[model samples]
Target: MTIGVIGGSGIYEALPLENVSTKSVSTPYGEPSEDVTLGELGGKEVAFLPRHGEDHQHTPTGAGYRANIYALKSVGVDRVISTNAVGSLREELPPRTLVVPDQIYDRTKHRTPTFFGEGMVVHMSFAQPYCPEMVGHLAESAREATDADVSEDGTYVCIEGPQYSTKAESEFYREQGWDIVGMTTIPEAKLAREAELSYATVAGVTDYDVWKDDSEVSLEEVLENAEANQESINAVIEHAIRTMPEDFESEAWSALEGTINTPTDAIPSETRERVDLLAGSYLD
Candidate 1:
């Protein structure tokens, strides 16, 4: 089984996967952000993809959430661990902290957030939103690798952005009990579920959102923290890969079962072949 790591923002490069090689791939959805880096990590074959193009040209809305997940699935990835840079919503969850969020509250408005389209439709169960088993592994790995305080349970608010939040908006999220805020993750997580890949997020908190009166957020600050904390993040990922069990169950894996709303006879043969990696068993 191949594992996938979707690196966000500053994490364009992963800790050198042993015997690494890069391969560009195409999926029915579109091109992925960049060529997938394939290599071995902790004796397991792993695939790595950068959410944004190598130059970070794609905006959050422009990132092809559908194509990205599909590309990973195409390459035999059954589970994915996504890294995100987030803004802190609560005071206690300060800047430079690490969090493994268990839930996501989507506030994104403009983005292609689903794989089902045209004649296809699906209703996926997202009660937990994240893979609990994966989150638990990440939490333990983070604690072992970093001295920075890491929280196990958090509610992430995903916003539509190339812009940071307004004070009122930030405060509103805090009122909703969200621990962190970011512009990505929701659609990517949702699409992964649709693709039948177990997905989890390891969020790196860069700054206090607009809710903090003491200091405002900035791109420079975000980049700086991401750079400083990367070593710890890499360490955690390596440890997680090393200690990951040979086999485990993920409720996220079964999320798409019985959720397809379209009749099988109505599905186009071309789309079926393209998506066989995700739903071959169900379709058969």
Candidate 2:
């Protein structure tokens, strides 16, 4: 039961893993953000990938969403815990608050949000994007591990960006009742479902965004809050991994059971080979 952790801003390093070894994994999609770091934490095998590369070179749109998810899946990761630095749309959810979002709204315009396309197609049920069980575990872990406010559930509105949101855009998201605004999570969450891996995120609020009259989102401010929140995020992740039950079962494991649309024989050989890791069993 190897758990995969995708680190967001200010979280390039993972929790102290034992007997750590780094592995560079190439996928059919392309290269992963960085080498997958493998180690043991709380007696569980863990694989960690930095979402934006170790040096934060990749932008949200440029990060290899398909490759990263594929790489983790290839390395025997059955569950993924993603950490994100996000801006709060609500006043009450202030900086340093940790949110376990159960819902996601894709405001992203430029990203491939699926692993199945071209010669193969899968209509996976995404009514509930995040794995409820995983979300519960993360939320409980945060409450037990941190004194910072933990939000059990909320909507994460994912936008396309290297740029922060405009004042109008920020206000619109707030009007939509979204809790947090972030750049990543759209395609990552969508692709995880396609790969049959349980996935959820611990979003650490870094700023109030541009919605607040007196608040102006800045890199310095976001980084400061993210650094401060890293301690709590690390604690929650370590505790969750340590206490996770080995026999845990997720509906995501069978997500491809009846979702593959193309008949096995009809799929192009090249396309079939490309998706073999994700949909091969279903195609058979």
Best by TM-score: 2
Minimal lDDT window, size 10, model 2: 8-17
By summed lDDT, the worst window of 10 consecutive residues in model 1 runs over 8-17
True lDDT of residue 34, candidate 2: 90
TM-scores for the candidates: 0.95, 0.97
**Candidate 1 local lDDT, 134-243, one digit each (tens):** 99999999999778789998899999999999999999998988899998897998888888888898888899988888979999999998777687788777788777
lDDT of 2 by residue, 1-284 (tens): 99999985344354777898999998989999999889998889998898889888999999998999999999999999999999999989999999999999999988988887788877889988999999999999999999999998999999998899999999999998999999999899999999999999999999999999999999999999999999999889988999988879899999889888778888988888899998887776
Candidate 2 vs. true structure, TM-score: 0.97
Clashing pairs in 2: none
Please report, in order, the local distance difference test score of every candidate based on alpha carbons. 0.84, 0.91
